[model samples]
Target: MFLASSAKPIDESLQNLVVEIETQNPDLLVVAARQLRYSLQQTNIELTITEPRPFNVLEEFIIRAGIEFEPAPTPQELASLLGLDPVFVQSTIKNLQKLQTLAPKSPITVTEQGRLFYDKGAVPQPPYAVQIYAIADSLGETVNFQAEPLNEVVINLPSLTSILQLNESNNLISTFNLEQVQKNLQASGLGLHVPETGKIVTAFRSIGSTQTIWRKISLFLIFDSTTEKLTIHLRRGKQMLDSRSKWLDLLLSEGKISLDTLCKLPNESLNFEREAAKKYQNAETAARLEKIHQQALGNSQKKEVIQLRDREINQKFLEIINTAKQQIIIYATWLNHLNINPEFIAALEALAKRGVSIIISYGLEWEPENLLEIKEKLQAIKTPEDLPSVQLLGLEEDVYLQEIIIDREIYQCGFYHWRNSHESHIPLGELVYQVKKSQIIQEAYEILSTRCQNYAQKLWQQAVEKCDIQLARECLCIWGTLGKLETSLNQIQKNNWLELLPIYLNVVIHNLKSHNLADDSPILQSSLLLLSQVEAEAAFIEQLRLAYCQLLSAIAQQNPDTALNLLNNEVWAQFLRLHIAAETDSPTEFISQQTSQPKTKRKAAAPSTRNKKTKA
Candidate 1:
């Protein structure tokens, strides 16, 4: 929705949100919008909470024993008879006397209160003083009634008359009832100190209350990177409220706030973080290459092995599946007992949407009925193209091996049933060995399941052909030398050149920054040469390449006007801007260097935890 200024701005309420945005991501810029001030009637409530206080087993037993016997037994006699310590018995007697359940004299005799407590099954309802603050909105609705504290709901905003206010309902204050207060107190989790099943408000009376209090709601501008769109979000207490909030719905219905609006607004940039600045500064090309080469050698040489059991298997296995960016190969026996729950299905669906190749291979044939069901469920989530494949290897011999290979690197193998494991019950402890992928293991796996080997090889080939670097050595060799890059580009499709451009550009920029090389460095020159060649071939690629190249050049030469002009004109250049911003010391370092003018500050409201806001 379009933003407008509110008369009484709650600038102080937004400071904490500013600090959070600055800390988490400086990319987001906060702007002010008009706020909705609603009235809340604060009533000082006094109520008696009846809680069931049950007597301990020993206390009950002692009272029962005294009542059953003709003459009550003395502490010494009872202790001796029950084989209990005399001192312990004496202490219990003292406690019983304090409760007025037994006589305070020499003989341990049950009193009238004791007989009544025993008759009522040893559960006594104790009354408690409930001095609580309850809040109610102008809509005849009680606020913070659902397991939330009152201190967090009510905002102390002075001078409510200066801001625009919503009309208070005439019956809002008169609608207070004992039943409502009781339900609220129960839901609010008050009187937790009482050891009882119920925190029922037995009695409620009004001590005092305010006429009407106002709370200022704030607006937030959220940027969705995927969609490349900005949207407005409203704040409720410490949370950026969802669309389902009653307040938001009410405002939308009244036309106080629009559901959709696009407005370009002025905003301020946050200072760059010092810790992040140190990460990308003064990197040398040779040193970076050497490090990459070493890491490659180490990964191939060493295999980290971990043994997982019970819930650890679930955690580690899910982690591998969830973090998979390229491919996932699961080799198991069958899907007869596989749960195929919503969560597992959802994860697979998300991975499929991300274009991850999934290959599920079963050694033995799956039961026909179960196979058909699993196939139908999986087939429903498939994209137009045959993305994920589930198959059974026609094997006569019984196989016991199972493994999950993520990105053809991390390998987890054992007898643990990855799919058949129940979610409700923690799976039985089993030895599952997790190790880094190796050639020997890969060959052995392929031999056991040859049906999927060709498909896996084809996928790997396709990935490499797209210039998607899977190994550190490949990144170093291809980007390190211009000749190697030219040779690789010959194999990649012309249509995929746009995708390849970014990979090449990133490598070039990374080398430039790490080596702290000049603009004319061989890596930079080679990248520019490739860009020129691609631009000469494809007109569309040329346009994108030019925008990015110009942005890069502007950043290097400290030309803020040129960079800003490109950013304003080209939406595609946003990524390039973000890349340069991340690499530089300050996110706005380029703009600040060329243009000395500061942006106009805009007052806006956003959400933040009260605790965090206070600290900020």
Candidate 2:
């Protein structure tokens, strides 16, 4: 029953023995060691096993054998027996103690049961514990018997040749299966879902190796449904690259790209398509809603308003153009100097080319001299077979007035013609309806269009036939006469004439003057004569005389200073005396006496201050 004590070196033989035992009875080592130690100790067998190793390799066996010793094995002896360096063994033991794997136990010692009579130590009992100690040493030191859980498996294939050599094995079949799976995903437009806890079992061969290798590679994938995010987790694999979102946005914005090509991509491409589909669906919904809203609202009223305004403007514009039968007269504040816009020049050019008369008057501010430059450029054309030559008049003086008279019947007056510096240099002008078909307007247009040399002939004929100047003078006199009449008339009658008489006079005068007819000029003489012939009071005659004088003054003021100076001396002095008398309550006798005085010699001078301030 004694335990054996021996120091044996670890060798291949012992390793083989442990391997055989582990294979035969894997569960026996621990159970057998415990059973043998308990059985030998029950027989009171004392065993002592000593080692010089610093770590106590036999300490556990010694304790179980019920033996006590003064010193344990030395460090070097423990190191040799365990096939480990002394430092490593000592550190490991210390660590085990700190981990509480080796807890404190009562030390075995010889002691008397009763008070102090030591029977001279009876022959020490045979050390039966040595046999159990030896068995415990063998069991604990058996590395092959240690059980390890199958945590991971690895295989290596040195080359492709080795893989081919192992064709008969399942490795080839597994490789083929993986390839087939990849192909199926590519063909079906399905993406492979790698499991979150799965591993990649790779089988490969070295370049010239005879054997194939198998390795388990870790991999995982996650799909977050809430966020619509897909992530592939590969422990030892490269990430996939795709430009699905970019390509999809491009296709959505441009509405050009083939859908068939997208669907033909491999399984890995599905994530991109998923995102694209969501975006496209949202856009489609929004567009459909917008279309529905637009359909519900009608635009009939808006269309009608636009149509009415357009028609009114167009009709007025056409009337202005059509009135220019023989000649077109235009007075624009500024004209498009570059001749690039719609202007009187553009219209007149068309008309003149067609043998119709055209005349234009525009301010010098518009750079009308530029017209000459343009003319030069046009003239430079080597082949001027059919281009029309246009006449331009730049009014550097008296340029403040802006008006257009077309063929006497049509006239336009407004600020619409001036193109502001900040605005586009386009022609824009308004037309005023005058006679609507009067001879006066027609003559004005003709006069404007006449050649410079022919202007005098036209003027002479107009003075006689139309008497435009005389009519204008008569109208001025009538306007003054009407103002005096309003004071003597009844309130109701005054209002009626106030509204009607001026309108009638304006229409008649405009018709006569526009046609250049001087026939209405006799109205001035006839009206004056009628007053003188009437047996009316001196006051009434004085009123008429004063009106005549004022009309003359207005005429003088509006005309050139030279024209005003051309008046007859006697006639001019008489007119001036009449105007002065109208402003005062002078005796009729005094006015008559003043008028009888001989005309005094006077220097040629501009119109008087009273006349110069008179408005047309």
Candidate lDDT (C-alpha), each: 0.49, 0.32
| Candidate 1 residue lDDT tens string, 294-316 | 44456544645556687787678
CA shift of 247, model 1, Å: 5.8
- Model 2 lDDT tens row, 27-119: 112001000010000111122221111224343332222222344444455557557777875554444333232323323222221001112
Best by lDDT: 1
Model 2 alpha-carbon miss at residue 143, Å? 99
As a whole number from 0 to 100, the lDDT of residue 337 in candidate 2 is 27
Model 1 gets an lDDT of: 0.49
Summing lDDT over every window of 10 consecutive residues in candidate 2, give the lowest-scoring window: 31-40
Please state every model's RMSD to the true fold in angstroms: 30.0, 51.5
